[model samples]
Target: MRRTHPANMFVCECITQSLFRLMKRKPYNKITVTDLVQEAGVSRNSFYRNYQSTEEIIRQFLEEKTSKWWSEFIAYPDRYPHVISEMFYHFLDMKEEIDLLYRAGLSHLLMEHIVLCGRQSLTGELKGQLQRHQLMKQNVTEDDSYEICY
Candidate 1:
């Protein structure tokens, strides 16, 4: 949405880049809105205009990354030799942020996000493998779906 307004986008982008840099250097709780605005070269109101809180920013960042992974995977569904392996590597690249989330006690949610992305972005070959391995239940349900993805 911010991208629609070039000036607002600059504000949003500056805030995002600054926050990520700060996050790498400090715990999320330790960072403040003032710190964000200062580091982002924007006013406190500018930060609030874009995000309700730092956690919201982090969530948005993760959501954007997951969306990106899905986009890339869908664009080349048959490109990967092993779908799950590709998923593993994709998450592997986020190790630092994942570790930070783990330390902040949000790993479980992130794990579920990753798994959901994995299940949704499954390639046709992977689906066939799941069917061949009988991962799917006769009456498919969320638990059965988890089994297939897991």
Candidate 2:
């Protein structure tokens, strides 16, 4: 088994929270690793142990957030549409951090992951819609076609 680095684990959580907070306030590029470590209350060495650079930390954060959103959406399919809207609101809410990540050139990877997840979610929703449509078609009474068409 591989041993986990304690410094990395600590720094990771700190950076995640700090970035989350920062995203709520300002653009991402405006923030620095120095700021991150200071806000996280961790030493520079601790931050370095887990991440070679701030961009790496941001990338990891984006990946984790995207995965979390995906899990939540899957868990409650009935709320998927609302979840998507919430995700958009989240991005708008975090515009500052997102801008910083984009300036750092890490947004591409993050956006790609998000887009892939969105595609998967959309495909799943479409499939469900098609199945429901098929069921409704099969159960249609003669008068139902006129009602549906009208």
Taken over the whole model, the C-alpha lDDT of each candidate is 0.69, 0.60
For model 2, which pairs clash? 27-96, 28-96, 28-100, 29-100
Consecutive 10-residue window with the lowest summed lDDT within model 2: 141-150
Best by TM-score: 1
Error of 1 at 100 (Å): 2.5
Angstrom error of the Cα, residue 43, model 2: value is 3.2
Question: Model 2, range 61-129, lDDT digits (tens) per residue?
Answer: 676666666676556645544444666765685676677667656678667666655455434454354
- Report, for all candidates in order, the number of backbone clashes: 0, 4
Error of 2 at 98 (Å): 1.7
TM-scores, one per candidate: 0.69, 0.50
Model 1 — TM-score against the truth?
Answer: 0.69
